[model samples]
Target: MIQRLLFAGLLSGLVVALFAFSFARVYAEPTIERAISLEEGGAHKHAAVEKGTISRSTQRNAGLFTGVAAYCTALGGFLAIGMAFLHGRLSVRPRSAVWTLALTGYVALVLVPQLKYPASPPGVGSAETIGVRTELYFVMILASAVCMAASVWIAFRIRRRMGMALSLAIATGLLVALAAVLMTIMPAVSETPRDFPRGLLFEFRLHAALMQLIVWGGLGFLFGRVAEHVVEHDRPAGVVRHRIPNA
Candidate 1:
């Protein structure tokens, strides 16, 4: 069963990676090129190409696909393990359980952290502060995940008495409160160059968030379908007991 789930996850990841790669190649790549140009002080494209060992064409093509494929495939494997552990425990159908987990995972790991520290394109932040920025971002994700887990546990404990709707509302409120506190307490990091084009920065950040949305949403939708089939196939057959009259 674990092997099958892992296989399903890997397949879904590969499928989504294609769509993500296409989107990146078309939309994100141009933005990246422009950012590089800006970083190079509007130097000729060839200058930027000469600076890096890898050409822009290669970076946007094979390099891009390889990175996306590997990330999505690993995410898929984790998603499958989550599904396996959470399958019957949620008291919901397999599809709903899978999607719920995906959505919550995105919120905890991606959305909340991004809210605090939005993604920056190349040439935005200084090389010196990259380590500090990375450490802070990781801390934010960990805090968000812990908060989400705690809220879920609280909801589950009270769900039977409070009903699903109220339980969920309470959990959501707790998540929000915790996130708000964390965001307030965490030190802010503003590293974007003062002269950077605001419009370009916005576009790049928007694309980055959308790309993540595509990956998570696609994984949930595709994996949900596979999980349904797996659950039904593994379900035990119903047994009918016959009463025998005393002989």
Candidate 2:
């Protein structure tokens, strides 16, 4: 099952890479180019130099695809492991699981931390604080992951007593409160240049968010289908079943 999931994950990574790359090329790339142009046009502009060993063509093509694919592959593996732990427990069907995985992934991985440390264009942040920014971002990621897990456990426990709907509601409220508190307490990073185009910044962040939605949602649905097929085939022969039931 793990082996099959790994293969499924790699395939999903390809799917993510295709969509994400397309979106980046069309929407994000223009904004990025605009930012770079501004950087070069300003007083900080440097003299034009010879092309580096790794050409822009390669960076836009091979580098972009390879990086996204590799990251998605690893993400898929982690997602698969997480699902495995919840497989027999959750009452989720394979199709619903798609949303579950995608929503949880986006919330815990992207949305939560993004509220604190949003993505920036190339020239927005200072070079000197790159390391500090990176460290804080990752720390937020870790905190969000932990909080998500705890929320799930709390919801599960409450479900046993308060019932599913109410339990989920309570858990969600708690999670939101915790996340809000964290956002307030976490070190802030306000690095975007004052002169940067607000329109371009919004577009860049919007497209970036959409890319993640596509990657995670696409990967979840694909992996869920693959997992369902595997589960059906693996079920006992003597057991009576109808069309690989949800959950």
Candidate 3:
């Protein structure tokens, strides 16, 4: 039983880690380019970056690392609570799909642009990128939200837990959002307010990270539980399940 639990924990952590690396790479790819500039042709194979640029990268990397880090951190959390898989009531393909859509859109459409330029073009970069770009991103955000709602609803139907899955997932999201909003908006009491523009940018990334953490953590916990229950109850106890399609 210990071995099984460890295996499950490791697998879940891997899921979270891979998603984190992939998602961060997607969003930070372009920005990483300019942050670490090509060096003068002094024969250094690697490029050099300014102290300011490196500082910026460090901040971005911290947020990106934390976004996926939640998954790994949640391991002992879910396990100790015995609902790491949300009692298996939250696990389902639909649930996973919803998370996938949201994460992908966030990394690709919402977060990536900020790496190269700014999320709100009017606010950060040149005026040339302001108009339709914002609208397109808003549309993508809406689509992602819709997918989350519909998928969680469907996952609820698959479990016999009387809508527990939906409630928990939604609750997790709301709690995270509330905390993030406050963190992003509340004015710091520090007297040094003028020096925080760059800090604000990285802090805002937490908004994106918070969402991913809630959704993916919930999915991993829920999926693990449901998968176990299905195998034990739906299939013959002694028979191993196969993934290939049947005739």
Model 2: per-residue lDDT, tens digit, 11-111? 77677778888877877788877766676677222223223598767877788888888878877777677666666656766556655876887898899
RMSD of 3: 13.1
Point to the candidate with the largest lDDT. Answer: 1
Looking at model 2, residue 64 earns an lDDT score of 81
Off by over 4 Å in 1: 42-50, 239-247
Kindly list the per-residue Cα lDDT of model 1 for residues 84-132, writing each as its tens digit.
Answer: 9976566677788779988999999999999999998877777667889
Q: Can you write out model 3's per-residue Cα lDDT over 1-247, one digit (the tens) per residue?
A: 3344445545555556666666555664444443233222222232232345446466557755665666554542344234334333333342353344335434433343333233310023323433455554455445444544554554445434545556557644653454344334432222212322454445445544554565455445554554354335545667854432211
User: Largest TM-score belongs to which candidate?
Assistant: 1
Model 3 TM-score relative to the real fold: 0.33
Clashing pairs in 3: 85-221, 88-225, 88-226, 91-222
How many pairs of residues in model 1 come into backbone collision? Answer: 0
- Predicted structure 3: clash tally: 4
RMSD of 2: 3.5
Evaluate model 2: give its TM-score.
Answer: 0.89
